[model samples]
Target: MAARKRKQSPQHEDQREKVRFYPAWCKRCGNCAAFCPQHVIEMDQWGYPHAVRTHDCISCHMCEKLCPDFAVTVGEETPSSVSRRGAAGPSPGTEGSLVSQDHSPERLAKTPHPDEEEHD
Candidate 1:
């Protein structure tokens, strides 16, 4: 039997404010979907959350606060209005750590494999 393709909602330009999802960093924890008051976010076939109802978003920042992975960002679409979490990385006091604090000798001894490179 052939593998069935997952159905994804068709993309559209609704002129709503911006909501960004960093899939690489997303852990698919579903907290964003569970906490959204407007029911805007929906889990994709792979269990990652996507903004299915972008127009309904009210910039409540609930998803921003609830995400343990720091994957979702809610902000307005303006030159001045940048990421809810600063452009560099997650803001202070977020659920996840911006940098890994494990500084044990074992951790410091580990090194990345030569063949592997970080993705963009």
Candidate 2:
């Protein structure tokens, strides 16, 4: 008999999904890059965060929850969020839902977004 190739299970398939990052919201903070236990995240010239090697991600959510600007939202992409593409939401370049009025721009600018261009 010929040897058969083993099929990958659903659990294994789920593990292969790539991690997505929101670049617009990122403030160039290196928190995600510094905190990644798997070292999956990396910073660009602008200091913004990017997922260089998603396969190494452990789904720790440290990048998402720790993000002060809510710029890094880590989660399984659901059909609902995708379906509502046109839904009204916060504007780009502004701290909409992720921060409160009490938070100042100086503070936000100081904190780097996982996916943001370097700013002075």
Highest lDDT: which candidate?
1
Error of 2 at 13 (Å): 9.0
lDDT of each: 0.58, 0.55
lDDT, candidate 1, residue 75? 75
lDDT of 1 by residue, 1-120 (tens): 111233334443542445676554566789999988888888866576777666666789999899987667787454323432232233222335243423232332233433335531
Segments in model 1 whose C-alpha atoms lie over 4 Å from true places: 1-17, 77-120
What digit string (tens of lDDT, one per residue) describes model 2 on residues 50-89? 6765655668888877777665655676653343222212
Q: Who wins the TM-score comparison?
A: 1
Off by over 4 Å in 2: 1-17, 79-120
* Candidate 2 lDDT for residue 77: 66
| TM per candidate | 0.52, 0.51
